[model samples]
Target: MVDVVACGELLIDFTPVQQKEKPGSIAFEQNPGGAPANVLAALSRFGKRTSFIGAVGNDVFGRFLQQTLIRLNIGTKGLVLTEEAHTTLAFVHLDETGDRSFHFYRNPGADIMLREQDVNEALIAQAAIFHFGTLSLTHEPARSATWRAVEYAKQHQRLLSFDPNIRASLWEDLEEAKALALKGMAKADIVKLSEEELAFLVGSEDVVEATAWMLGQYDLQAVFVTLGEKGCFYRTRNNFGTVGGFQVTAIDTTGAGDAFVGALLYQLLEVGESMLDIPQATLEDMVRFANAAGALTTTRSGAIPAMPTLSEVKSFMEAAR
Candidate 1:
């Protein structure tokens, strides 16, 4: 049985390499990406059995993503290929300050073509955790399909995990998008968000107040707030703490959150850790391990390529201590 089954988008991220002398000109590097796929790959690399459920185009990019996931040891049995639409493409440009910007070339891309019937309820039922992102909920059939998966997971009494990964450009309106995102959060047992994400979602500048407000409103089992480099802060039903991340020279932070989230879920499932009433020590241990995984990912490049193996994470953790 798969420890986690992730459902959502799978696309290509084209990163730019600028010329040293000619600042205006740059070369592009193709990388396999998509938040859900990154998480699944990370979990698989961490020695967890992971399966992915999503749609991909019949194009070269789709085939490349499929081969990439297989190389990471993620099961691709649930992947659906659609011939009507092309695979989604994200053109990423990083400025001199290391700030990233995106240009999406998706109009009815394969990722958004996911249908309700495409979701395999039985596969989700067999998994320990079900993870998804809000991007799939922005369109028609995929939106309904994502909700269907959530309903099925809830029916099976499995853990529902979510990461909003909100992109303002995709939504019809900010208010409507926030409402829909909150609906997904309500169903999620564990909600992971970056500091900026929390502020934007809650409309607050104070991270602590925003997180505390979300915890109070949603009645969630656990809330995890990731602070890049500083580490992760978590609060459970009755426990709370901050786990420091391993010291590392970060190169590309593209997949850091996915690595951390996957490792966190893997540790929770491996140890049978409960979200209902988790102990403070257990939370710390899990976050520390996750932080190590995230830190290790930043030392490399790309989303799927940078995910560390279980042995690598262990060695890095040992060296940190």
Candidate 2:
């Protein structure tokens, strides 16, 4: 049985190495990416029984994505290869400060063609945690497919996790996107968001106030608010803490959030502690480990390419201490 079943987009990101000389110029390097895909890769590398559900184009880029997931040992039985569409591509650009921006080329991309029938009910039933994101909710068939998976997961009483992973450019209807994303969040047992995402959800600029509002309004068991260089803030009913991020000359912030979430999930699964019963020291250790994993990812280039293995994460944490 898979420990985590993640459903959503699986596509290639062509990240540019240099900015354009002019406003409209283009430059890029192929990088396999997608938020859910990156999380699945990270979980698999840490030896979690992970499954990915999505669609890919019957093209060279899709082949690379399939090979990458299989090499990492993630279950890809639910991945559909379609000839009717091309693979989804995100043109990623980084400013001088290493902050990233995106340009999507996703009209009729294979990922958006995911049908309700593409989701595997047996896999969702067997998985301990069913994870999904907001990107798939931006369109028709994919939206139906992802929601169907979520409903099935809920029916089986499985733990649900949601990450908005919002890209404003992808949605023609921003209000609809926000409503749908909030609906997913309400279904989740665990919810994670970046500082910006939290602000958008709560309509507040203060982190503490935003988190407080979430806790007061939602029936969530856990929530994580990632603070980039400041690290992460997390709360469960009985435990709350913030771990300072590791000092690193981050070359790219591409998959850092995914790495952190993946590592956090891996550690939580290993420990299998009741969130309410977790000791302060153990929480600290878990946060430190996750922070190390995330910080290490930024030192490299791609999203999946940058994700550290469990051994690598352990080594980095050991040396840092």
Task: Specify the highest-lDDT model's number.
Answer: 2
Model 2, 1-321: lDDT tens per residue?
Answer: 889989999999887665566666656789899999898888988989998999999999999999888988888898899887999998887776566888989998889988998898899988988889999999989999999999999999988888998899999977887788889988988888998988887788687777777877878887888888888888876677788888778777888888887888888889887555678778778878888899999888879999999999988877877
Local distance difference test, each candidate: 0.86, 0.86
Candidate 1 residues lying further than 4 Å off, grouped into runs, are 18-24, 96-99
**Regions more than 4 Å wrong, model 2:** 18-27
Q: Residue by residue across 210-314, what tens digits does model 1's lDDT show?
A: 778888999688889898888988877687678887778766777789998999998888778677656777778889999999899878767788889999999
In angstroms, give how far residue 205 of model 1 lies from its true place: 3.1
